[model samples]
Target: MKNALGSVDSVLLLGGRSEIGLAVVERLVRDGARRVVLAARGDAAAIGVRLKDLGAEVLVLDFDAERPETHERVVAAAAEFAGDLDVVVAAFGVLGDQAAYEADPVSAARSMAVNLGGHVSAGLFAARRLREQGHGTLVVLSSVAGVRVRRVNFVYGAAKAGLDGFAQGLGDALHGSGARVMVVRPGFVIGRMTAGMRPAPMATTPEAVADAVAGGLRAGAETVWVPGRLRAVFTVMRALPRAVWRRVPR
Candidate 1:
C-alpha cells in the first residue's frame, strides 16, 4: 500500500533482470518501498542482493511470461510474500531481429506471445489483485514503436501496438476501482536490450526512463514519454503520409 505521501511500500517487477525495470525498482526502494518481489525466468540473485542492501525485504520468484497459465499463481505468490502490492511493473519483452521475423513467422509469433499475450494475462491478473486491494498502480512498459509501427520492425511494433491499446483499455476499466495504470512510452532506449544496435534519434537510457517513471508515479500520470520531446516527435510521425513514412530509415 502507499503511504500518506503516495510513496509505495511494496513493489513487484515482472521483468526482474530488465535494466529499466531494475532502475525503477531501485528508485521506488529509495522512496521508501520496503518490500520487493522480482519475478523472472532465471536467477535474480544480484538484484535481490542490491534490493536487500537498500533495506528492502526482497523475494525472487521463477516466472515464465510465455506460460500464461501460471500468471495467477505468480501474482498470488507475490501478494502472499509482500501483502498488498503497491506497484506492479509489467516490463517483460523481447526485441527480436526483424529480418528473422520476416523469414520465420513462427519466431515472430513466439516473440509476440511473450511481448503482448503474456502482458495481457499478467496485466489482467495484477489488475484483479489491485482492484481487490482497492488501491495500487500497475505500470505497463509500452514503447513509442507501438505509436507508429514502422516497416523496419513491424513485428515488434505490432506487438507493442496491441499492448498499448490493451493497457489503455485496462486503465479505463480500472478507473473507478481505485487501481490505476500508468503506460510508459519510451523511444529507442540505449541499454542491454539494444547494446550493439545504432542509437536512434531521441534515444534515452534506462536511468532516464526510470526517472521519468518515478516522476510520473508521483504525479499520478496515466501516460509518460521518456525524454519528454518524443511525444511531439511521435505526433508528427503519426501524421506523416505513408509514402514519406515508409522512406524513413530504422
Candidate 2:
C-alpha cells in the first residue's frame, strides 16, 4: 500500500548486510517506508534491530546469492511480509581478487554465479511478483566497470555487464505492468567491501549511492550513477578505443 513516501510502504533488500543496501533502506525508512525485509546469508538480527529502532517493521529472511534455487522463495517470502511489496533491491555481489580468480577458475566461476546468475534468478522472481501485483520498483546495483570491461578486473566487470544487461532487458519486459526497474551504476564504493582496495578516481560512498537511488525513485529515473560525475566519465571511457584503453592501469 501507499505511504507518505508517495508510493511505497515495504522494501526488500536482497543484500541486507550490504553497506549500500542498508543506506538505501535508511533513506526509504526516512521517506516513509513502514516495513523492511532484509534478506542475507547470515543472521540478520543486528540489522533488523537497527531498522526496528528506526521505526520500521523488519522481517529477516535467509538468502544466498550463490543459491539460485532459493531466489523464488525469497521473493515469495518478501511479498508475504507486506501484502504489496513496493520495492526490491538487488544489491548482492562479491569482488574477489583478480589474481586469485586467475589462479582458481572454480572460485572465479562461483563469483560469476553469485554476481550474475544470482541476479538473473532474483530479478526474474522479483519482476514476476511486481508485475502480477501491478506495482513496485526493482533497484539493481550495477557497476561502472560493467560499462566497459577492464583488463585488471575483467571477470568481475563481465559479471556486472551481464547483470546490467539483464536488468535493462527485464525493465523492458516489465514495461506496462506498472512495475519499474532502476539500475544504479557506481564507480567504486570505498566501504567495507572495498576496505583495502585503492579508491578509484571517482570513488564514492555507500551513502552517496543510496542518496542517488532515493533521488532516482522520486524522479522515476531508469538509471542513476552515484556522484553523477561518473556518468560523464563513463561516457568518455566507453568511447575510448581498446588500443588506447588497454594501456591505462587500474
Candidate 3:
C-alpha cells in the first residue's frame, strides 16, 4: 500500500502531541507512512504506542519548542530514527490570553519567540535535511489571523505572520531542491488550544484541517486555507480600513 502522496515512507511531527499534528499524522499513516517520530515536550508514550500498534515503527523524542538551541539535536534525533524524512510538520504554538499579553510585553515577546523563533530554527534544520535528501515536504501551521492582525490576538497574529513569511522565503530558497513546503492557514480551530473560545465563522476541527492538509499535499499546493473560504475572507479583511479593523471585538 502506498501513502497518500504515493511515496512517503517516514514522517516527523515536531509538535507530536498537537491535536492537528496528530490528525495529520494519522492520515499519513493510513496513506502508507510506515515509520514515524513523534517529538514533543514530554513522553509521547501514548501516541507512540498507539502508532506502534498501527504497524508503524514509532519513535518518541524530546522536543522543547521554546529552546531554540536544542532544535538541531531534535532534528538529529529524527534523522537517527528515519534516514530520509518524507514529511516534517512544524505545529507547536500557544494561544495566550490577549489581556495578559497586553499587560506584559515580556510575556508577549516570549510567546513570539516560541511561536516564531522556534520554527525558524527547526525549519532551517529540517530544510537542510530535506535539501540534502532532495525530496521531502515541510508542513507549516499558519493561521488566518496572520493574514490581517486583529485587536483580539494581534501578538499571536504577528508571530504567525513572521512564521508565514519565513515559510514562504524558505520555500523559495528550496525551489530547486525538490523539497516543498506547505503552509496551512486554518480559521478558528476549536481544539484543546482554543478551548472555551467562541467559534469563529467557518470554524473547523482538527479532522477537517487534517483532511484539508491531505488534499493540499496531494494537489502540491504551497498554501491551504481550511474551510477553503478563508482565502477569500482574508482578502476582504485585509482590505478593510484601519478604523473598521480596530473595532473588531475580542
RMSD values, in order shown: 1.0, 1.3, 1.9
lDDT digits (tens) for residues 1-250 of candidate 2? 5433336689999998888999999988987888899999987778787778889999999999888899999999888877788889999999998899999999999999999999999999999998998888999999998999999999999999999999999999999988989999998898998998889887899988888998998888999998898888889988899998999778
Answer with 2 or 3, whichever has the higher lDDT.
Answer: 2
Q: Which ten residues in a row have the lowest lDDT in candidate 3?
A: 1-10
Per-residue lDDT tens digits for candidate 3, residues 1-250, read 2234536789999998899999988888887788899989986688777677778898889999889889888888898878888889999988898899989999999999889999999999999988888888999999988888887888999999999999999999999888889999999998999888889889999999988988888888999999898888888888989999998765
Ranking by TM-score: 1, 2, 3
Top of the candidates by TM-score: 1
Best by lDDT: 1
CA error at residue 46 for candidate 2, angstroms? 1.6
TM for candidate 1 is: 0.97
Model 3 global lDDT (CA atoms, 0 to 1):
0.88
RMSD of 1: 1.0
Candidate 1 local distance difference test against the native: 0.93
Ranking by lDDT: 1, 2, 3
Q: In candidate 1, what are the lDDT values of residues 43-74, reduced to their tens digit?
A: 76777898899999999998899999999999
Q: What lDDT is reached at residue 131 by model 1? A: 95
Model 1 steric clash pairs:
none
TM-score of each: 0.97, 0.97, 0.95
Candidate 1, which ten residues in sequence have the lowest lDDT sum? 1-10
